[model samples]
Every structure is written in C-alpha cells, then in structure tokens.
Target: MADKEMRAVYAETLTELASKDDRIVVLEADLMRATGTGPFKEKYPDRAVNVGVAEANMLSIAGGMSTEGYIPFAATFGCFATRRAFDQFFLSCAYAGLNVKLVGTDPGVSAAFNGGTHMPFEDLGLVRMVPGIDIVEPSDPVSLKALVQQIAARPNSAYIRLHRKALSPLYPETATFEVGKAKVLRSGTGVTLAALGGLMVHNAVTAAELLAADGISAEVIDVLSLKPLDAETILASARKTGLVISIENHQAHNGLGSAVAELFAEAADRPARLVRMGIQDQFGEVGTEAWLLEKFGLRAEDIAAAVKKALKG
Candidate 1:
C-alpha cells in the first residue's frame, strides 16, 4: 500500500476531473485548504469558487449552477453540510434532482481536536433520509478516489462524507470500489463483521486475529455505500455466519448498524444475532481522536468484544 490519505486522494481526483471537464465547478465554503482542495484551486483557479464560511448560501449557489448544466462539487465541514444547509440540500438539490456533489469533511470521530461541535455523528442518517440523494463514506484513499470518479461520471445529487485527517493505507491499490456494493474482504463461516468508513479495515484486521486465536473463523465485509446499501452481500454473509456485528464511527442508530439490521431482519429466514458497536446516544466532548474512540467503544478490542458477544449468543 502506498502512502495515501483520504483528503489527498480527493484533491488529486477533483483536480483530474477538472482537467477534463470544463463544466465541473468546485464551490468550497472557506475550506479549500482544510478539505484538500488547495491543489485543485491552484490548478483550476477559474473553475473553483471559494465562497467564504456561508454553507447555506454555497448550497443554494451550487444548486443553481447545477440546474444550469454545470456539475458542482460543494465542499465544507460535515456539521455545516447536514445541519446548517440541510434544507438547501433537501429542497434545492435533492428534491429537484440537481447534479450536485456535497462533500462533508471531518465526519464522526475524525473531527478530533475540533470537538463535538464539529463532529457529525448523524450526517449519514440525516442525508440518507433525503429523497433522491446518495450517501457515501469511502473507507480509504483508494476507495475515495474511485468514489470521486464514480460520482463525477454519474451526475446525481450525492453526499460524500470524508475524514478531517488521513487514515492509514489498508487496502490494495488494485482494490475495485463500486457504488451501492459491499466488498467481502475476508471469508468465514462462524461470524460476520460488517463495517463502514475507515473503521472497516480496523475491524477486519482485529476480527481476523481474534478468530485465529479462538479457532472460530469470521468473515469481514466493507459497506462502502451507506444508502442504497449492498443488501445482497449482507444477507449472504448473515445466512452463512448466523451471527453479525456492525462496526462504525457514527451512532448505533440510523447508520451502518441500523441499515444492516433492517436488511437482515427482512431477508434472512433465520436472522443472525446482531450487535451494533459505536457511539451510544450521546454527544462527544473535546478530546483526542484516540481517546474519543476508546471512550465510545470504537477500538479494535471493542469490535472484537462485540463479535465475541454475538458468538456467545
């Protein structure tokens, strides 16, 4: 794996897309540097619009541009994207089916030093409810690049959540990422662990080690796209394992856990015992990312424990 970060990949992909498409305009809410759009702005200064600090106005402007045959990529923090400009996204962009790509940076615990005010634990759930809007959270740089290119090619209203900082490279460069599809990273028959975002790689690695120690094999699946989930893969894993645990950095409800539970409950004849591991129904506080993850039971050990609990039941 090469040294690639989610933000760096986003910058590279957006820059590449801007090179070929003249109608692809970028609107950043004073976060060009923070969201890794500095390179794109430097290269395509004329195409990128830096609308300072006004996320609601940015969404409206982007929606207007999208209506006029211009593909607009709006970048801002997750809090502003979902909370501040939600109505704009719902009515102006999604409701009208405008070709707008809403990029939300510093989602979930990735906000780190930005504290609870900046962290967006409910962004995915919030965005998923919007009609005709796609929700996505790429697991790593490779997947992030693939997602950017995918969204660019398929002109639809979408919300792509990103981490404030880079995560460690975990997947191979050759790994293929498809929208509305889940990738099976590892296979087993005892228990299944489905994870989303950067936590996928961590949960998979920990499950592998735990299974090896206990001599109980565990399967790992990465739910790349949150909305329009890959229900086929999830049902298949549940049928095979009979025990499922969903890991995420967001809250337990209306996120990856809730999505998987709904699918398994409907499809699986003998529904697997499912456990959701994430931040409970509570707000985050000012702390380091590591401390916050541990406090909310998002560590690899916590994932392993959840899987063990599922197995016991």
Candidate 2:
C-alpha cells in the first residue's frame, strides 16, 4: 500500500522538481492546503503563489509567468480549473504556446461531498478540444509522482487530472511510466476493460478478476493519457478481444469513453463493439465516493455486469 497520500506525493514531487529547476513555480487559487501544495509553498515561499479564489486570475498569472521563462503549475478544483477558467487556459496558455501545468484536483466523483457544482464531469472533453494540450490522469502514488515530474519537465501546456487521496499502490516502486501511452496490467481475450483515474483503473482490474471467475477473459488497460489516446496498445487489445468497454469517473459523453469511440470510429475496419460506462450525462450529486460510483454504475461489480451484458450482445 502507498504510505503517502497522493497530495503529499504531489507536493513532494513538485518540491523535488523545483529544487533542480528554479523555473518551476507553484500557483494556486488559494487551494494550497486543498491541493496539498502547502509544503511546496513552505519550502519555497517566493516561488509559490496564491491568487485567492480567482481561478481565472490564477491562469492568467500562470500564463504571464510562462512567458517570462517560468514553468508554473496552477492548481484548483476541477470545476473551477476547467469551466471557470476555460478561456484563460485556452487562450492565455495553450493558444499562446505557454508551458503551464494546470492541475485539476478532485476530478469527477472524487469531489465527493463537494457536490455537482464542484465536480468536473466534462474536464477531459474541454481539454481534449484544446489543440495541443497534454492530458494525464495518474492512477497511484508511484505513477502520480512519475507523471507529475514528467509533466513539469515538458515545454508545452498540459493538464494534470489529479485525484488527491491515498490508495493502495497499484504499480511497483520501480515502475516506469510515459506520457501518451496506456499501461496494460492484465491480459485476456474475451473483452477489453479500458479505464483511467485511480478508482476506475483499480476497479477494472477487479472486474477482470470477476470476469475470469465466470470463465471470461478480460484484458485491463489504464488509459492514463487522455489526449493522444494510445491507439497502438488499445487497438491491439480491442482487435484480440473483439469487444471494448471503457469506464471512467466522468461523463459518458466526452471523456475517456468518447476518446475510445473516436479512435474506434477512425480505425474503420477494426474491432466494432464498445460499451461506455460512466455518468449518463447527468449533474453530479452530493454523496459518498462509493455511493456516487454505485449510483453511476461505475463500481467493479457494475463493470463486470456491463462486460457480461456486452458479451451477450
């Protein structure tokens, strides 16, 4: 199990990265504690910035900082990160080709009690439409640390869909991760269970095990990089399994599921069947994470059932 909470890993990783590169700066919409960047702020008081509750102003500040050769990682709630500051991020950062790491913490149901207004079910779709923005959702502490360092080192704009809580370690301490690639955790032939985010990927693996008990083979792929969907890896799995089901902690319309759909759509004569399991285009509600996941049919058992239903077709 990962001993450190994800926010600790995030802050520790940023502190490590900043120690070597003076260009790395931390920006928050007065969410240093919420996003776990308080340690980073403490370590480098001059380097960490707080823009109060103004997410848009934070992005604009980050954009300006990017122009001055400073790499800024702006952190805020997912809802405010996308819908609240969409234009500033789209134009001030991405459009201007600035290198700002915009961190959207507590994506989807991870917002839990924060409720619908705080939940960002369409964050990926918004960032996906941006021309050259990089998207990554790390599933565990190991991957989160590795990806955050990689994201901070990049010279182009990127969005880090962060889930700020602790979970059992999903990858080995020696695991190597790369941007724009999906990591395969299990292999099977009956169907492909594709997922991203911490909760979804962990459930996908459990769902695979459940499928195996029923004499069905399920392959699990962690679609960590939402943008640049790893077509090579996912396509091969879909081709072998002949069915694909993508699960996410987001809206079914335009998140990872939609990305896979577009990929399959472009593949032409490739594998055909796809089942997207997620929030059915509804507003997020105030609930426990478990309740929200079950309410939206995103639990491991739900995933297993969806696989069975799709296979029956």
Candidate 3:
C-alpha cells in the first residue's frame, strides 16, 4: 500500500466535519501550519481561533467555548499540550466533563529533528492521570479520518496523539473503528504484540513477520485507543497466546505497556508474561525517525527480540 499524510487528512477531515456541524470549532496555538489546521482556519475563519503560541490560553479558551455548546478542537505540539497546559486542560475541560478535543501533533519520535524540548514521550501518561479523558492514536490515514470525526461527536473530553507526517496505510479506506477497541491485524498462537500510535503499530506488524520466519508465531494488535482500553480483546489474545509484548513510541510507564499490565493483573490467574518495549525513561533527542527508533531500541528487530525473550522466559 501507499503512504498518506495523516496531518493533511486530519485537516481535510476536520474541515468537512465543521461544514456539517456548526458546533465544531478549532483552536491552534499559532502553529497552524505545523499541526495541519491552516485549512480549517481558511475555510472557517469565524470558527478558527489562533492563540499565538499560548497553549494554556488556547486550552482555557477551548474549555470556555465547550461550555457554550461548541465542540472545540485545540491543536498544538504534544509537549505543550500535555505539559504546558496540563492544569487548564484537566481542571477546565476534563474535570468539568466538557466536550473539548485536544489534538497533540508529532508525538514522541514523530517530532523528528525538533530535538528534546519539542518531543513528548510522556503526554499519554500525563493525560491519563486526568479522570474520564479518552485517549487515541491513529495508526494510518483511514483511522485518523474516522476517529477525528468520531471523537468530536462524543460528549466528553478527548486527547489525540497525532503523527504529522505521512505513514504507511494499515487499513483499507472502508475500515471502520469504535473507541475503546483494539484491531487485531495478525493472529498467531505463540506471542501477542500490542502496539500503540504510528511507529510501534507498524513496527509490531513487521516484528510478527520476522517472528513467523523464525518459526515463532506472533499476534499483532493495533491499540489505537489507550484509555478505555479494549481489555476484553487483549485479555482474550493473551490467554490464547500466553505471552504479550507491548510496543509504544512513548515512555513504557503509564502507557501501552502499563495499560496491558493493569489488565492482566486485574484479570488474575492468567499465566501470561508481558514485556514492554519503549523509551526507557530517557528524553527524546534530535535525530531522524529511523535513528531514534534504533537509539531507543524500538525497531522491528527489537520487538521481535523482545517477543523471543518473552517466549523463552
């Protein structure tokens, strides 16, 4: 399949949604071009609000708009969205249960070459601390389009971990999705690889292929929704496979790996081992996507090796 620009698709999708629903509005922290909200600003000038590099103010404004019955989507770099404006987002929107959608672009290594300050490896964990906040990451262009519309239609607050660049398509154009669900891309009997966001999802699929060649069967799951996780699907797969490896672009703690661990721990009596493959409490550095993957031990071979280790232990 071909690669498609996820941020562009997000801009296009949001523009289409705004046309149909007047309640839909967009807020950007003066990085409209980088976060792919320029078109929405152009198309709906009245509904678009650029807060000029002030992420906290942008989030507060979105919360205020949400109270007035407007569905506001606030866009900014991932680091700023979660760290800089965490207080406002949590207290103003999520605590109040307002219908605000926060879009954090270039999550983790996807902020390639932007260096450590711009990179956010703990945004999911930060957002997850707030109660009743829905979190999602789209693996491909199709899911990005669908979930953008899906999250906006909901009546509660949400956070979207977005990769701004084009990514290899993981699903057909017609593939549909529901919040709090996992998509099993490949099924096997030996190991289950659960991955989140852009890089890990694609890498897990490749890792499964490598495992198959080595006589190891691996199941691949795209965990698009981090919060309100698809526990049933994950538990069923783990019970069948007896091993699970969680792959993520963010920090291992309080992310995909932690979520899977919580599920298995709660279920009880399940004899499955979980190995987490992710950034090991280190901050992101300036590098290409490929270099960062290798540096952080997040490559497909790394995932395959983790699966092999989990199988042996």
Candidate 4:
C-alpha cells in the first residue's frame, strides 16, 4: 500500500474525469492550492472557476452551473464549506436537486495549525441536515479517487470531507468503492469497530490488531459513505459481534457515532451495544495531527481501551 495525499489524488482523478467528460467543472473558493485542485485548474483552465473566499457564493455558482447540465465540484476549507455556506448548500443545491459536488479539505484535526476556525468538527452534522444530500469521507487515496469519480458521474448534491495532506494507503491501487457502501476491512465475532474518514480508519485497524492480541476478535468497518449509510453491512456486523464501537475524528454527536446509533436504534430485532470514541463535544485547537489525536483521545490505543471497556460493561 503506497502512501499519498488524498487531495492530490482527488485533483488528479478529477482532471482525468474532466478530460473524458466535458460537463465536469471545478469550482474553488480561493483555496485551490490548499485543497489540491490546482492540478485540475491547470489542466482544464476553462473548466475551473475560483470564486474568491466566498464559500456561499461558490456553492450558489455551482448550483447555477449544475442547472446548465455541468457537474461542478466546489472546493474550500471544511469549516468554510459547510458552516459558511449552509444556505447555498441547502437551498441552491440540495433543495433544488442540483448536481453539485462539495469538496471540504482539512476536515477535523487535519486543519492542524489552522486552529479552530479552520478546523471543522461539525461539518458532517451540518451537512447531514440538508435533505437529499450525499455525504462521504474517503479513508485513503484509492477511495478518494473512486468516490470523486462516483460523485462526478452522479446527479445529486454531495459533500466529500477529506484531508489535504498525505495519508497512509488503506487499500490497493485497484481498490474500487461505491457511494453508499461500507467496506469491512477485518472480520471478528466479539465486537465491531466502525470508523469513518481520515485517520480514524487507520486507528480502527490498529485497534483491531491490538484487540486480537488480547484474544478479542473485532470487526473493522470503513464507513466512507456517510449519508445513506450501508446499513446492511453495519447491521450484519453488529448482529454477529453483538457489540459495536464507533470511532471518528469529528464530534461524536452527529457524525459516525450518531449515524451508527441511528441505524442500531431502528433495529429493534438486532440491537447491539454501541460505544462512541471521538471528540468529547469540544472544539478543535492548534496542534499537530498527532498531538490533537492524543488530546482528543482518538489514538489507536484509546480505541483499544474503549473496546475493552465496552466488552466488560
């Protein structure tokens, strides 16, 4: 598995897709370099549009572009993409059923030194509220490229949260993915570890290995498709394991934890005990990714401990 930046893969993949599909267009809110869409802009200069720092305007413009039968991808910082452009996202894109793809970079702790204002801890929560919108957080470069292609080929509003920097590859180069599915990386019968986006998937895999050393079999599920989540996979794992733990970089309230809880809550016949591991209702702060993961109790060891505790109680 090679390590590569997801943003760079996203740009390269989008550029490739645009070459074949003339309707594909890229839009940025003056953050092409930060979001790694510069390659797409450079390759297809006429197909790229930078709308300054106005995220709302960028989304609105994407909605208008979608009406013209163009698939537009609007990119910006996660915080600005969702928090600053809720109106445009909900009304202009989702409500109107426009084919727009919203790319949010540096989600959660990936913002690093950008501090709380730039880090988005609740972007998923905000986007989840918009009716008829697809939400995705790719776990690796392969998944990012695959998901970007999927979003571009579809005709619905979608929000894709991803890190701008390089990430450890979670899948092979030929690994393909779908928009509303969860990939089970590891299988177990004791407990199920469900993780979404960023480093959390990597942590969950590590935690599963640690749990195995302790004679605890844990299933690991990479939840790339956030909206219209793969309930079949989640439910099957929960039923087999009888216990579940969700890990994510976002707040535990309305992110992966909440999504899994909602799925389990409705499953009266196959209910499983679920414990969540994530930011404890706190805001992000300035720090390196490693420091922030420790500060927020999102380390692989922390997830292993949570699984141990969940098994006992």
- Estimate every model's Cα lDDT from 0 to 1: 0.83, 0.91, 0.90, 0.89
Which residue pairs does candidate 4 place in steric collision?
Answer: none
Question: Per-residue alpha-carbon lDDT of model 2 for 79-197, expressed as tens digits?
Answer: 99999999999999999999989999998998999998898899988888898889999998999999998888788999999999886788899999889988998989899999989
Model 2 gets an lDDT of: 0.91
Name the weakest run of 10 consecutive residues (lDDT summed) in model 2: 1-10
| Alpha-carbon deviation at 201 in model 4, angstroms | 0.2
Ranking by lDDT: 2, 3, 4, 1
Please give the lDDT score at residue 193 for candidate 2.
Answer: 93
TM-score of 4: 0.98
Clashing pairs in 2: none
lDDT of 1 at 292: 87
List TM-scores for all candidates, in order.
0.96, 0.98, 0.98, 0.98
Per candidate, the number of residue pairs that clash is: 0, 0, 0, 0
For candidate 3, lDDT tens digit of each residue in 213-307? Answer: 99998999999999889998898899899888889999999888898888888886874888888889999999998999999999999999887
Colliding residue pairs in candidate 3 = none
Name the lDDT value of residue 130 in candidate 2: 91
